[model samples]
Target: MTGEYLAGRGAYILGLITKRIWFRASLFSVAAILTALVAGWVAPFIPYELSLTVGGKAVDNILTILASSMLAVTTFALSASVGAYGSATSTVTPRATQLLVDDRFTQNALSTFVGTFLFSIVGIIALTTGLYGPEGRVVLFFATIVIVAVIAITLLRWIQHLSSFGRVRDTIERVETVARRAMQAWAEAPHLGAQPPVAIPTGLLSVYPADTGYVAHIDVAGLARIAERYGLTVHIAELPGAFVYPERPLAHVSEAVDDKARMAIKNTFSILPDRRFDQDPRFGLIVLSEIASRALSPAVNDPGTAIRVLGAGHRTLADFVDTKRGAKACIHLRVHAPALTIDDMFNDFFRPIARDGASVVEVQLRLCATLSSLAAHAPDIFGKIARRHADAAKMRADDALSFEGDRAALHMSDF
Candidate 1:
């Protein structure tokens, strides 16, 4: 049965839209323009004496200065942001750049800068056209004061944000935060609130992917609705973050699937060129592991970074295990999707670091320790997988570590 997903298609789409920089910027611009126009409406409510106290010339000068300065500030901000993106790509991993791009603090700062610029421009235009009489000018002046204050505070915060904006720790924190969120969401709605799919029944109809790419999102609720309406069982063959080809099955329908049904089913699975972090827990783990791998690379040779990321990965997994997800809340009884395997997560989160940092004793020690700790997290589930990785890491250390002391040190560690 294709049951409802915790997040519907609209929510999934909205999640993507909100991550965009321009969306927030466009909203801020529109709001600024509205604010400029609203002064005329507010003008009537202000007393004539208040208008007399407000100087049109001073308001005009402030707007002029604000407009000119904001243009320069916005340009600098863009350049800084672009530089940070480049830095994150080179020092961290290209995969992490998207997170930085979607950073709310940076986005809001840029939006404020752009919005304030537009607000100033509109206010100046209104002033020049005499759209704001003395009363209107008073309202506009007060608005300008508020804008200036906001800009001042924003500038200070932005300056502080830029200090570690694209640094390695910052990027890793960003990845860790997202990875935790994904894990938490998964914990809340295990298997997307669907039954763990069993072996396909003999006569199940297969739905193939139309394109070759990663499954970015799956509209689970849509499938449930379609399945319920059509009176069929829909077993989701792939989860978000899965790579798919034309030959691969996206889902299996229990009844005969018509052209309309096939298309509808396919639409529920959004395939994109790259995997996204949202709705994809494993992708976050993979990206975090990738960061550790990059840090372990000979070009960078930054083991400290890899070590820090291990801590993040450990914390992310530990949080998932520790979360009080009492029972499997299966909401979408109609949709059957596979549950995430701990082994795969262990591989995704730690295998690469173990492989790449095999030579470093500190890396191996940290890796083995984290694995043993994870094994202790849920002995039945994580114990075996954690031991598997720990054994692999120990084996790698045996080959890579020249001194017996180093080998013995790793062998002696227990959780």
Candidate 2:
């Protein structure tokens, strides 16, 4: 399989798993129970016998308290998490909620809490059933102490995480981070290591998707293998982030193929309900723009957030361009995929901000400055696009700002 194909598949699976709370929690809970069971089984084999001052009743009382308190904590945590998710969805863009849902610290903290609670419950039941002898009780007591320590640390961190979990600023940072990774991946393998076809071959047979959805991933390796096996040249019409329907062609084969080969080609394309950032950097850019647009809305009127997002977008794009210099070459494939264009990137990320933040002087000025900086560092085409955006933003500023001085300050000459 091609590296891009494997990376896409891995990202798809990891994305699905990390977004769900139960998967990590269940794994932790099982580990907790298993650890307790294993400790109990080995307790009697200890070589040293010691006089333990702690009594069974005392241990029982401690376990009882832990179990009850943990139940309360878990319930509270669940409620708080729900509220955070709801608040994030209502206040910020709903697209950002996915990042909050998949937060590692929050997931780890909750899973740790739930697992420790299960550990205590299992330990208590084992102690009460006479399954553990005196030595086993001693082991369980020590284990309980360790569990308490763990719970204390987790609780402290969870408190810290909750402080900014669903806040707009935190959500934006999370989105930026995901966007950066996606951009870097795209920069490294612009065409999934396949050379772009010179042009669409004449008389190519078109292959369409069976259903309508966003193109989540493309199995380039599999496509290449199929092309090589069938002695055909395949041209991918849709990139990973493109939405495809029954009427749209997914790919174009140089020659007509049997139903089985057509089905094989179709299977290489993964269609999902929503676009993901890992394979589709454009989705990330779109999300960042959405946040900026939301911030610029009359209801929110948060220009600072919009400005910060602009800076973030600038940095991400700059890095994407800078990294291209050192990007590793990919193995050639029989299939060819189209490269993402700078114009599309700008449209996805900056156009909305420019349109929505037209009235805000600070936002307009920042956009011009950012675009100018990008233009300075980018190729001729990038510079041209940047100038286009800067000029458009200035027009909006002139119309929106009442003061001539304000409009003059935002003049294109400054950029």
Candidate 3:
């Protein structure tokens, strides 16, 4: 290990932080505190007569009520969000739950509640401590009323959001949105801004990882810099979502490198205990398949959801194929990365669901149609894999499904 901190890219780090629930809530709370102090700053411009009519008593009472009530409301909102996560895990799939945890709608609702509570607390503290004079009190009163209105609006929006917060359809849509974006990015830059891989040289030195796990992210720019400094050609052996152990070679260097260079190369790859959605587009496909598999389980027996996932998968893959034809060459000069294959993507998205939903005639029909549709869109790219999965799924369906009529209907499609 380089013993250097691996922070990934700045933009990637910022993306991760923004997805966090506490980060949003903390920002809101800080804003609320700052808003509380503004009353004193703007008080000088207000008329003294206006301050006489609106005493501190009304504002204090409102703040006290908000402070007391908002805590309970915030607690309840948190519980609901937690419950949604659990429901999504059980009903959808564990892999799909992280999206819920990082969902902006859920985070925003909780942040509003938490921020409002903190604002109330600050207002009450200021009033009791005589921090604001009469004009400040008048300003504070108007601020309290505005905040109350905001709270009311937030509550209304929260109620509407809760209706389908963690529902299977809602969660699946979220997954589709993320997967499509990742796929589009992958299509646009299949090599992650690195040059396409060339054949390995006769006798290159291999660089091994110190830790073992999935490659969550690769700092290609960092790799390029290292390659430039060492005057070496770097062939990446593993990409993001690929598992590695201490024994596995992460890259092959053209020549022997110093310890610092070796460590710098190693530190460029961020290996995590689990895969993340940002870089590895195929991980998202696997997750959608997992969700379908869970729905097809005997305990759940929701073939409709499985069929729906097939459509989501189809749409995501279709978008990739459409964008891939015009993809531009990557710009990085020193780093070489293997391109992600559509064959692997087809397997990641369709295999498990084909196994789990084998017996469901509707699911099989939908699966065949989904594959056939993709093949129709880009036969050169997906036709072979689509037919391959369709054949495999057909055999499974034929065995699991006893009725000949259902099998006849499945055979009706030319998938």
In candidate 3, the residue pairs with backbone N, CA or C atoms under 3 Å apart (3 or more residues apart, or in different chains) clash, namely none
List runs of model 2 lying over 4 Å from the truth.
1-11, 51-54, 325-328, 379-381
Full-model lDDT for every candidate: 0.87, 0.81, 0.86
List the RMSD of every prediction in angstroms: 2.4, 2.4, 3.5
Please report the TM-score between candidate 3 and the true structure: 0.94
lDDT of 3 by residue, 267-290 (tens): 888788988876678988999999
Worst 10 residues of 3 by lDDT: 1-10
TM-score of each: 0.96, 0.93, 0.94
Candidate 3 lDDT? 0.86
What range of 10 consecutive residues in model 2 has the weakest lDDT sum? Answer: 1-10
How many residue-pair clashes does candidate 2 contain? 0
lDDT of 2 by residue, 1-415 (tens): 1233335454656757767899989999999898677766877775444415655454677778888898889888888888888988888788888888888777887888788789889978887788877767777777788888888988998898889989989888989988887777777766766667559967889999998999988877778889999998888899989989999999999888999999999988888888877678788889999999999999999999999899889878886787662233345467788887888999999899989998888888889888988988885757888888888878777778898877888884556
* Best-fitting candidate, scored by lDDT: 1
**Cα shift from native, residue 7, model 2 (Å):** 1.3
Off by over 4 Å in 1: 1-5, 326-328
